[model samples]
Target: MNLKDKAKLLPQSPGIYIMRDSLNNIIYVGKSKNLRKRVYSYFIKSNNVTSKVEKLMKNIKDFQYICTDTELEALLLECTFIKYIKPQYNRLMKNYERYVYIQIDIEDQYPIIKLSSEIIEDNSLYYGPFINYNRIFKFLEGLNEILPLIKCNNYLKEKITCINYAMGKCEGPCIKNVSSKEYKKHINKVINFFHGEKDLIKELEKFMKEYSETLEFEKAKIFKDYIDVFNSVFKEYKHILRLNNYNKFIIIDYIKNSIFKVIFINNHNIEYVDTINMNNMDKKDLEEYFKNIYFKFYLINNKESKNIVTKEFIDYVHIIFSY
Candidate 1:
């Protein structure tokens, strides 16, 4: 059958598609709802494909697809296939290195601490691909203020002698002052914060209330300070909700040595921000990986991207600390 015949057979439902070259090399992997419509749209002579697409089309000889239940399911399938095929025409998620993320080993007694330019299937949590190293560090410092979890293996020595320990700042893991249970609690808090918990402010409020009842003013102050930091990160929410609101999500990206990316949900959606430092990962490297990872980043969010006009985060940090 001709391309048109194959196209006519594509389902109107969501699914992942693959474009292969004469050599049977997969050049592109994508997902679409209404596969017939999306594939046909690509074949339009005037569609103005990207330079990469044009080259891909020149070598294209055949294609295949797997239908899915929903657009989101197609998205998941697209990501999976792109990783497996590492196609030339697809932009892979974490395929690029403009932003580097911090990876932690979830399986070890103490996981190895390191930086990553690639996404792993391991159960470990990936923190960022920050374009600004300084901002990433600043954010990590803020995180440390809320959670007393040790970030790295500064406890290799039998004696707890890290700088933070020496300075009487950290309750050393080496010293066992921080019990496993307490450490686990801090881990959960950090994870919840990063994963966009809508109840974050509420959780803090509850913790503060309990701390006050126990007369643990110092501990309560920590919660208050975090709330202050949280507020600084977001401009005053017109309406703070006890839950996530996902009408539309917008991006406010601050680019420097890392990308300090913020996800702002409008029309009552929750606002979540995350930063990753790709300072160590060069653009040339990420460019090579873009086909695999970059495409996972939905550019629809870019439609809403604009220069950051507010220094509210910086201003809030200053005002809250002045007290």
Candidate 2:
């Protein structure tokens, strides 16, 4: 249909509108507050792209739309539809479908834990869709550190706790040193941690106070450690502007298995161009995290080996802590 003909049929509601070419192929998927206004904006002379859109518009014949409840809904629906169709000319907006998040099935009878891009179970809660493996590993590690979660088994009652708990690294929930109810409470703390609410600090303080009053100094210390972790983590790293470098180059790298990301600052703007591998550190060490994560991500992405991640290089990354 012609522009004038198409304008009359468009609605005033929020929705996703698809523009088609002469061959009836979807060229673009767009969303807006008002379908009519959005579609009209595309038809205007200035709205036409000087380069690619010129060719697309010349081949345009008809279009389609799906109505949504609200503008934000329209925007979300548009993104979903775009991912589904992956229309041409929207190359920059191509979907990020690679990352998967670790979800804890808290509401289930056995609580099946797994990695997922989207949580399909309405019964369970999703912890993250973390794009980085290092982050995911830290999350699982942190979860294990504070909570009574069983990392080795699906069902808590299946078997006895592992050697970690025997060595004081765990709380021994698998053999029932901790109850399901208490485990659930720890899971709630994990939820609070993920939320990263300011009130979480307050709640942590309150919980610490209660534990101290009850003479549970060990438990209070655990909470204090976690609080310190949150503080140090928030302070040492950031994504926004920084004073470390004039270039303020941000190095964002993700490890493959977990939701780990490290934001490093450098005077140089170079990225994946230079490899700063840091993969030798063990999983339990907190000090070597940034190095371990960066190295694994670098190696995984580039298909390199640990020999490339030298001890001297690890020391260099550690020096940044002093800076």
Task: Point to the candidate with the largest lDDT.
Answer: 1
Worst 10 residues of 1 by lDDT: 308-317
Flag regions of model 2 displaced more than 4 Å: 1-23, 30-84, 88-141, 154-163, 191-323
lDDT of 1 by residue, 1-323 (tens): 87867888888877888888888888888777689998877677866678877787777799998886545446645655665567877764424334455566655444433556666767776654434444444445555554454655557566645677666556677777766566565556655655565455666677788899999999998777766655443322212211123234434445344654444433322233344456755888656544333344433333342222122122222222221
| Model 2 C-alpha lDDT per residue in residues 20-83, reported as the tens digit of each score | 8877888888887789887886678784367877776776678888876445445545655665
Model 2, position 4, has a per-residue lDDT of 51
Model 1 has an lDDT value of 0.56
Model 2 C-alpha lDDT versus the unseen true structure: 0.56
Q: What lDDT score is found at residue 191 in candidate 1?
A: 54
**What is the lDDT of every predicted structure here?**
0.56, 0.56
Off by over 4 Å in 1: 1-16, 45-48, 64-86, 92-142, 156-160, 166-169, 173-323
> Alpha carbon lDDT of residue 236, candidate 1?
26
